[model samples]
Every structure is written in C-alpha cells, then in structure tokens.
Target: MVSMRSALRTAPALAALLLVLTGCGDSGPAAYGTDDRTITVDHGEKFTLKVPANPELGQNWYLASPRADAGVLKYRGDREDTGDGDGTQFFDFTALSRGKATVKLLFCPYGRCHSADEVASKPVPTATGTPKDSDQEAAYYLYTITVR
Candidate 1:
C-alpha cells in the first residue's frame, strides 16, 4: 500500500506536468466574418477577418483605412483563397492593447481599374477617377474591434 505522504508529494508534480502539457498546445487564431458587426479580442491574441473576394475578376478587397491613433491593433498579413476557389480573402491582425480600433476594407476592381498610387491614397480613389458617379463606386466593409 502507498503511504499518504508519498501520494501527497507526487500530486503536485503530476499537476505541474499536466499544466505544462496543456499550455503547450496551440489553439490557433480566432475567426470573424462580415456578419459579425463587432468583435472582442484579448490582448496578444491573433484573429482573422474573412471576406468574399475574387482577384481573378479584378474585384478584390484591400485595406482602405485602419485606426492610426488607437494603437491597439496590428496588421499581420493576408492571404487570397485556400485553394478552394471560394473567393475568400483572409486578413490577419493581432490585438496589441486594451482599446478600440476600426478597420475599413474597400472592394473594387483594383489593378484593372485604378492605378497603384490611387489605391494607396488615404481615401481610396474611385474606379473611373470620377467623383460621385455610380461607375466609380466601390463596396466598403467596416469592422470595429475592441481589445481587452
């Protein structure tokens, strides 16, 4: 039979081993969609915003504006599709601090319809280089993120 003192001594070491094993696993990033109006994330956590886009048709999504003063979020990177041809665009971000930030994405015929300089402008330029015209309009997406 095992002594009480021996079991007590082994319990703590077993508990510590379990904690190390569980904490080593990767849970991956959290995902959000367009339907989600707002998202809440913890600081240092990674998250992804998936949107519908078709680069082959010249209709693509690009980051138009990100909250510069908030300083609570950081843009990691992005990917176009996952070999499924579902026209999915993945935008990655990391929560840096406890605050709120807004991300704006514009869907338009980027390369075929506008110049690189035009797309890089603060307020994204219209497709036709015209103002207030339906032909120049592009779809817009806005996401508000709150980090805690």
Candidate 2:
C-alpha cells in the first residue's frame, strides 16, 4: 500500500518518465524509410543526386523526376574502364511539378544496346506536395539521407 504523501511525491517523477518514453518536443513529419537511401524534393525546388559514373548491375542508387518531361533524370557510365570516380555522374532536377511525384532508382545498363535496350528499375518511396509558405504559393519538400 502507498501513502497519499508518497503518491504525491512520485507524481511529478512519473509524469517526467512518461514524457521521456513518449519522446519530448516535435518529432517533425513521419520518415519514409528504414534505411538512409531516400530522396525527396518539392516543385520548383532544386535538388542534386550523386552516382558513380560507372556502376555494375545490381548496384543500387537514386533517381528522381520520372513523371515530368522537363525534369526527367537518368545515369550513364564511362566509355572506358576508368576505375576513378572520374566517371562520377550527376542528374539534377531544377524544376519539378507541384504534386505527388513518383521516382525510381534504376539499373541503367551501359554499352551498346538495342532500341529495345532493357533497364531494371524500382519505385522509390516519396510524398511530395506544396506546403503553405508565407503568402506565396510554393512547393515544399524535405528529404533526409544517411551514407555510411
């Protein structure tokens, strides 16, 4: 059995404990992935993607802006066997549409291929929309990535 005074004394401590367990302060928006290979952007916002100028099949990377014609992105490899990142390639999108856009991390094959050249790609998770910013109508998006 607990006395009234003892219960009262532990009340504040219990409250603090609950807060810690539940997490204090703003947690921001819900994250999109279990890993750090995420990419996100807003309409009219600029973003950058870095990929090895040369990568083998099954190698994983990021791609963005597949739906919009002006912002479509792709990757290409070096012509020769240059081991250096001298083959490092980048596909950046300066202007994207203002809505939910789907992006794919693709396995773009190199070398001479057919007009029906095959490329494997997977859908990368994303949630894009225009958020109210000040008085102006603008697209807003936030993306987080971690590299080991």
Candidate 3:
C-alpha cells in the first residue's frame, strides 16, 4: 500500500533528522570544540594551559603571546567521559620561557600538529601579584584565543 511505503520513508527521514539535530556526542576529552576540532589556551601569567570543555574537530584556537621558542602545550583527559557542560582544565608552564606567550593546540590526540587551523593562543602576563604584597604592581596584560 502507498501509505505503508510513505510511512517507511518518513521514518527514515525522521531518524536522520534526529541524528543531525542531536549531533554526534563528544566521546573524547571535554576539550573546546564546535563540531570536531579541539582548542587550548594559556591564561598568561602561568604556563598552565587551558582548554575549553567541548572542542570541535577541525577548528581554530589560540594562546596569545607565546614564547617564540616554546613548543606546543598538551592536555590529557579521560576518553570515555563527557559532562553536563564543558569544564576548563589548566596546566602549569611556570619554568618555561616568559613574555608575550601563546600555546599550540592540535586537532588529534597528544601534541600532533594539525596546521594553523587547529591552534589557539592567549597572552601570558609577566606576573600575578596579590594586593597584600606591597611590591606588587598594578600593571597587567590581556590576551584572547578562540577554538572553533
């Protein structure tokens, strides 16, 4: 019957629509991503690199003002876990070179470089001082990085 055929076709269409709408769940680390790529950032003062909770594949991210010689900053996370929302993770790079700093983020696992499209940068401040420290200066710098 034409009705039966139409019903079958509609079912498949609806199923496809659901999948598209929901999108493939992020099974990897809660890295910054819009669809498939991943993103990481450097908060400036500390070498501890930061990454967005949900990273999309094949997107761009940055760590502002990275050391000219400093290599890519890496992040590790549980593969089987994803949470209610993206959570930020930080890593320390205190001993590394200091100055305007940016960190490189790869698309794949580990430090694998994936071209200019897969990295993000953030500026690292020279120092972070507390108000209680009389020697602390009020000067500070800001940097921005994005991961699509």
Candidate 4:
C-alpha cells in the first residue's frame, strides 16, 4: 500500500539503524571457569574468572592470595550478579607480564564460609575435602594462567 518514494525514503534509514546497532555490542574480556584449568593471555590483556556463588545461601568464593604470582598477573577487583538463588561472581585480573601464574580460589560451600581473618588460620582445604570433617565445608579451585 506504500508508494515507491516512501519505501525508498525508509530503506536508507533502516539500513543505517541496523549498522549502528551492529556496532554497539560490547565484547568484554575473556572469561574462564573451573573447567578451564589452564589459560593463556597476552601481556596487558584483561580477563575474568567467573564462579557461581549465592551469598544468601552462604556459598562464597574468595581469591586465595599469596598463591598467584603478582609480577605476572594483577588482581583488579570483583563483581557479582544475584538471581533466582543462582548467582555469579566475577574475579577480574590483568596480565602484567610474560610469565606464568597460578590462580587459586577457596570455595566455602553452603553453610560453611569463613571470615577474611579466619581464612589463614585454618589449613587450605582440597577440592575433594568438602565436608571432610565436622560442619566444615571448604574446598579449593585451582587454575594455571600463562601470560605471553
């Protein structure tokens, strides 16, 4: 029902809008998880480690400091998203130099989280050691990162 002139006028505008929308997406840094035990990145590149954590249920993930080599990787910060009792936690990092670094995360499962001060007081728990003893539900997630 439209005239040729009207269709022609809208065609260019629609194409421009489509091009703009295509270029608006944000491709963030590389993301990893427990399954990705080994990772590599270029110097100065940024990356994040995504873990599942629902603080409302006492599921916590802490960056195990003194584990990763600071000279190679710099810990930036952390962020989280909560929804439907299934939340996600993010640990940000930047590749500082060309070397190898190991990142360790201490996971405190539901009903068993420790304070910052208490993290060092107790021995590091193995990933398989979840609930190994009375009321203590602690585990570790380990990863090796190589920077180039």
Identify the candidate with maximal lDDT.
4
- The TM-score, computed over Cα atoms with residue i paired to residue i, of candidate 4 is 0.74
Candidate 4: worst-modelled 10 consecutive residues by lDDT: 128-137
lDDT of 4: 0.79
- Candidate 1 — which residues are off by over 4 angstroms? 1-27, 66-70, 82-84, 109-137
Residue lDDT tens for model 3, 42-127: 33322334433233322222333232334332222223222454434333343232233333332222233333333334232332
Compared with the true structure, what per-residue lDDT tens digits does model 2 show for residues 104-148?
Answer: 433233432211113224332232431111112111123332211
Regions of model 2 farther than 4 Å from truth: 1-37, 55-86, 108-116, 120-148
Question: TM-score, each model?
Answer: 0.63, 0.31, 0.24, 0.74
TM-score of 1: 0.63
User: Which runs of model 4 end up more than 4 angstroms from their true locations?
Assistant: 1-25, 128-136
Q: Which candidate leads in TM-score?
A: 4
lDDT measured at residue 24 in model 2 versus the true structure, 0 to 100: 88
Give model 2's clash tally: 1
Residue 53 Cα positional deviation in candidate 1, in Å, after optimal superposition: 1.2
lDDT of each: 0.69, 0.37, 0.34, 0.79
lDDT of 1 by residue, 1-82 (tens): 9999999999999998998888866667988876764899999999998876657656566776544234798898888783
- Provide the lDDT at 117 for model 4: 43
